[model samples]
Target: MFYFFFAVAALITGYFVYGKIVESSFGVDTCRATPACRLADGVDYVKMNPKTIYMVQLLNIAGLGPIFGPILGALYGPAALVWIVLGSIFAGAVHDYFSGMMSVRYDGKSIPDAVGHNLGKFAKQFMNVFSVILLLLVGVVFILGPAKLLAVKIGFNLDKNMAVVVWTGIIFAYYFLATILPVDKIIGRLYPLFTACLLIMAFGLSTMLIVDGYTFFPNGVGLANVHPKGLPIWPLMFITIACGAISGFHATQSPMMARCIPDEKCGRPIFYGAMIGEGIIALVWATLGMTFYQTPEALQATLASGGPAAVVDQVATTLMGPIGGFLAIIGVIILPISSGDTAFRAARLIIADFSKVEQKSIAKRLLIAIPLFVIGFIITKTDFNIIWRYFGFANQTLATIVLWASAMYLVRHGKAHWIASVPATFMTAVCATYLCVAPEFPLHMSADYGYPIGIAVAAACFVWFMLAARNTPVEVDAVDSPGVIG
Candidate 1:
């Protein structure tokens, strides 16, 4: 029954989200020739087919967060899978795709820039400040936690200091290559190979677990025991599924990819396809987490002792012996690096947009990278679980804001206003309430850190939106002038 629901939800949500991306990009003629839609000559603006773009976007968006978020979500047992899939399709994928298209329509601007244009200068500054702080927080949490887990698997002593040093070097290498090497050459060839490896490793591990007859839920466990917050599951469901639902990372990544899209038609596959890949990855991890650890207590124990990568490694070893363990380690190592690369690139783009720095300049890129590296290093000493929880809260808050902004853009463009606005408004309310009530919930991290940060972000978003509404509207006619996309 659990597996059935999981698989069904995955397929349905995957199709819906992917289809929305395609429809929004091509159906609305957002991809038509315009100055804002033109491709640049360099790494940030190279052209590519939809398929290649899809692969790059998939690899970039699907990261350690999906793996860990589901593991965390499984605290509510198999029931959590339902919300993970549904919310991901409606909230997560929509936010990512539309935000990307909105950025393209606004001259390849990011979420902050869009906010500034449609809202006001204050909204833009608020978003920029929050975004940078949130990015640093996310980057540090992602790099250090996963690096520590990977170190343990690879026999590197797994100390905090060593993990920071090693992952920082890895991030620097990724950025150096991405900035120096041609994106078309690298993403075209290297990404496919990387994706293949990931698929094979993930499939093999999942197949092995299923073959071993690992149970999805532990014996004697019931709904009452699974979620101590009681059976009215809406709030826990909303908070548990972070990136699988909506994330700030997408807001940054979509635009970074949008800048290079040669035509508007390509946006559907790149934006929506990337999200489907991310949803699938989440399903795989959620299934593994549920199957590997029979009980919520057992899963919590494993995570507490060594974090999620350790649990994943243990599951792999249980299924495939030494070879599976090796593959699991490799998979874990790749997850964070792939995400870190995306994170670094997105952070640089956001910085460039906010500061008006010339992205083409190597010196400017280095300047952007340096402070990010330093901040990432400084936060490595913090508790991984705490950081992860805080990031989830911050990300959800950002997602709510972005979704509202995207819906507003759709309305302004005279699209399906109600269709977009209803879901956007509902999700914002649900997520906001969840964050407010989360501190009293049964989840460990939620009560400790997640809910509080969520409340603060929600409050700030509310204020920002109110202020933005007061600003005089930017002339839509001027923005839509001949040869202009923004």
Candidate 2:
């Protein structure tokens, strides 16, 4: 119980301290207008209140990733808490804040543009196609997650072809409509309501956890390796809790809000603050995962009997009774739907941005969106398990790239690059080692070879960055406004 409270306090404290340090280093200024104001298209770049923008950014990134990922990650033991608190604070929030602010600095272009400017043109091209594929995978997974949940809530046997098909159609229809509509009309309006559901669910469950006399982590924190079978803690745990800790996907989504924020000042609260909010939700779910079951082996056995989504239903129903269960159902259902549509929306904008195609016209939007949807829907018909596994490696790989890009932004401007550079290097090592060692990843090298190869590759990346990041005769001018960094 005390440990849970401490975890919450660390997240909040980290926001004020580490989050603010990130904001100051970026030199956020209120006097200047943002691209949302300077480049309003009445479509995606409409100015919104900070609260609404925060809600949109939060829901845009939250999805089923945090909940489902943490449930799976809880299989590792209380070590998940250590990762969630520290990773979210030092790595996740920094990754998210800089990504959002960088978009604002670059006039609300896609991430490829930002990466291109900092890394190189080739990196930009790779990121553009890579991000589109990643978002497509994310889009399909989110759609399938909710449709299954809807089937469960309706008490339908999902094994029946018609039940799964009908739910999929309903969710896919919503995703299509939400993708084409203006931001203010659909996402900006509906997202706040969805955010409210998520918060209420978190708060209610959190209160029950504390008020109902549940003791978590009774043996206390350690490198005890409490996983049912001794899964190495290094890369598996990091990959499992990707979104809650640090994710490349958030970098993609941050620009969507970057195109809506009216002033630079709100970037701190909206972008950095929203990530802190996500960390809190993740902590709650992780705590629930640790306590709601008896042991790691029992948890594994239960997972074998039923999946992560089923665990959410069982836990909520047991802990909160029927009413809490209903609210949890609503919250869980809203999460993936809100995130799924935006995944497609982000993909549309990325492709359009890559083509330099104007997006104001409904016809142009439809032209790009139709093909992507057809491809995504077809991909959804394959085995979801394989798709999700591949996504984790790709997801973290993108994060490593974004972090290095961020470090580049800091270095080119002659500011302290340590903040971004440190985490960037660490994640690079994590992802590289995971691919080599993790049996699921395509590389699949033995652990003995993987660790040395991981360190060597990461060190090589560091050297490459130091060579490439030499001060250009002219600064890249990452910030567009009069707000200049010395």
Candidate 3:
């Protein structure tokens, strides 16, 4: 109980304190015209209230990250809570705020263009492909995850395969429509309600935890790792909880909300504050995870038997009872749908930006979206576990790039760069090492070997950054403008 309360309070407090420190460092200029004001096309760049944008940003970034990621990450025990609190405040929220503010400062450009502007033309070129692939992966994963959940909830009266197919088609159709629709029309209109339900679901679960005296961090709840496979804490745990703590996917989603923010001042609450909200949501979910099964061993075994969806079903029904169970199902269903639509939309904009195409008309939007959707739909047929493995690495890798780009932006524009650089350096190592040792990835090396390799890569990056910073003279003005078309 105390653990959950401290985390919640700390997240809220972080926003007022650290959030401002970040805002002041970013040099948020309230007078500067935002994309919504400077490039109002009434389609994607429509200006909305901070309140609405906050809700949209929250729903988009939070998605299954807080719920799914935390549940899986909690398999590591109490240590997971430490990462959720520290990483969210220090790393995750910081990443989101910088990315969103950078977008605002640069006419809400897709993160690729922002990367190019800071890291150089070559980096931008690489990120363009990288960002698109990541977004498509998110789209595919969200589609499959929620579809399966809802299909399971519907029962086995109908053919399970057919149920999955039906749900897939329904989800993809909505993704297509939402992708091409105007910013304020669908996502903006409906996300607030979804956010409401998501929050309620979080609070409801917490209520269950309290009533049940769930030992979130009691003496029995061991903080040490207890994974059945002995998945190393360094990389696997980091990968598992990417969303709640920090995720590169949020960088991609930020521009969607950035295009709607009314002012530079709105950036803090919409970007940073929303991340804090996600952190709180993550804490609640992680706490629920801590208390859900009798022990980490039981949780791991259950996860092995039934997978994450099964875990969700058992907990919702077991702890929350039937009514809470239904609402939990709704919240779970909404998680990916809200994020999935935006993922496809972000993918479209990323492609359009790369090709220098305007998105004011639905026809042009469809022209770009068809190929993307076709690819995403095909990916759904592959193994979910494989896609997720790639996603965890890719998500953090994207974040690493953005963090570097942010550091570069700060340097060029003459602000403190260490804030971004430090995290960037750490995430770079996490990605570099995870690939070398992770079972799903190609290397298949021992976990012991991966750590040294990770350390070397991080050192190499830090040295390279220092050398580059010293050699590369700082620029007076920012490279990217605030009115460039997507």
Candidate 4:
């Protein structure tokens, strides 16, 4: 029953959200020859074949978030998987693909820049402030979660501080390689190999579990033991879905990839297809979580050993022995590295956009990397699950705002009123109201600061949108601007 709804929801969302929103936004010639559309020659800017671009985008965007978010969602049983699948197709994929397309049309501008250009100066500045905060939280939380997970799996005796040091080193290595090495070589040679390994590990684990006669369905599947003081199932489902669906991180990744796509027509396949792939990854993880544990006690024990990563490792080992466990480590490593590379690149772009620093300079890149690593290192000691939840709320709120901005752009440029406004407005309202009303629900973590922050951001955006509508003149110049790919 749950899987039925899950498939239905994913298919519907793919058609409506991914098909319409992203495709319409970045269709052929939509980003041709504008100032925002300039393509640089080298790793970050070199144009690539559409198919290659699609593959690169998929590998980059499909990271640990999808796996962990869906696994967490499975805590509420298969009912949670339905929402995860639906939300990923509709909200998550659309957010990532359109956000990338929108950035491309704005000369490689980010979501914050788009807000400022389409809305007003205040909107841009407000978004920047919120974005930096959100990024800090996201960077720290994401880094820590995977690091801790790895530590537990390997039986590393390092404390949180030491674990952070090791994690930072790994991140730094990826960033260094990405920045210094040619992207084509990396993507052409390395990315495929990495992705192939990921697929092998993923399928190998699944097959092993099945062959071992592991129960395909969780036993005692009920939401009875969900944490009452924590955020409830429905709201947490929304938040978790946001990680898979519409992460703020995508705002950074999409534009970077857009600049590298060989032609304007490639945007749809590269951006939209990548997002769909990410949704599939999330679904896989959700399935794993469901099949692996049947009771709250089992889930807790797995968590105590580590977290979702450990649970995944345990399951793989249970099915395939030590070889599977080793493969799991490699698979886990790929996730953080993929996300970290994107994170570093995104942070560099954001910094370059806002500051006087030149992205071309090695010093400038290092300057940005150092602070980011430090922040990530410091926050490694904090509880990752809590931070991840907060990130979902804040990140999703940003996605809602981006969706509105995209709709406005389509209406103004393409004059697709019904197509543009209806879905966009619906998503905005659903996401906004969900965040705002969520705190009132009887759920664990309801009283957390993240929920209130999300509410405040949503409320402020509502007011900002209203005022901007009344006072500011809409600028459609960006619609024709060319974007830089990197």
lDDT of each: 0.65, 0.84, 0.85, 0.62
Looking at model 2, report the run of 10 residues with the lowest lDDT sum: 477-486
lDDT of 2 by residue, 269-387 (tens): 88888888888888888878888776777677777876778888888887789888878878987877888898899999999999988999999999998998999999989887788
* RMSD after Cα superposition, model 1: 5.0
**Judged by lDDT, which candidate is best?**
3
Q: Model 1 clash tally? A: 1
- The sequence of per-residue lDDT tens digits that candidate 3 reaches over residues 1-486 is 776787788888888998888888888777788999999999899999899999989889877778889989887877888888888877888899988988887788899888887777788888899999999999999998888888888745778778888889999999999999898999989998897679668888788877887766553444678665677788888888998999999999999888988889888888988888888888877777767776667777878886778888888888788888888878988988998999999999989989999999888999999999999989999998889888989999999889888887777777888888998888888888888888777787886798889878988988887766665565666654321111
Candidate 1: regions farther than 4 A off: 5-27, 34-39, 156-164, 175-182, 185-189, 216-225, 228-237, 434-486
Per-residue lDDT of 1-486 in model 4, one digit per residue for the tens? 355335646655675555665575545574366332365645456666667666667767666777777777666666665565556665666667677767766766666777665555676677777776666665565556556666655535778667666866675566656644446766545666677667766667666656767675555444353532344654456666555555666666677676666566666567766776676666666667767676645666776776777777776667667876677657766765666566656665676677757555666667776776666567656667667666777776676666666655554454443333343454555455465555433442433554565456556655554444444333455564322111
TM-scores for the candidates: 0.83, 0.96, 0.96, 0.80
Runs in model 2 with CA error above 4 Å?
Answer: 155-161, 471-486
- Residue 211 lDDT, candidate 1, scale 0-100: 79
Clash pairs of candidate 2? none
Ranking by lDDT: 3, 2, 1, 4
TM-score of 2: 0.96
Candidate 4, lDDT over the whole model: 0.62
Would you list the clashing residue pairs of candidate 1? 31-264
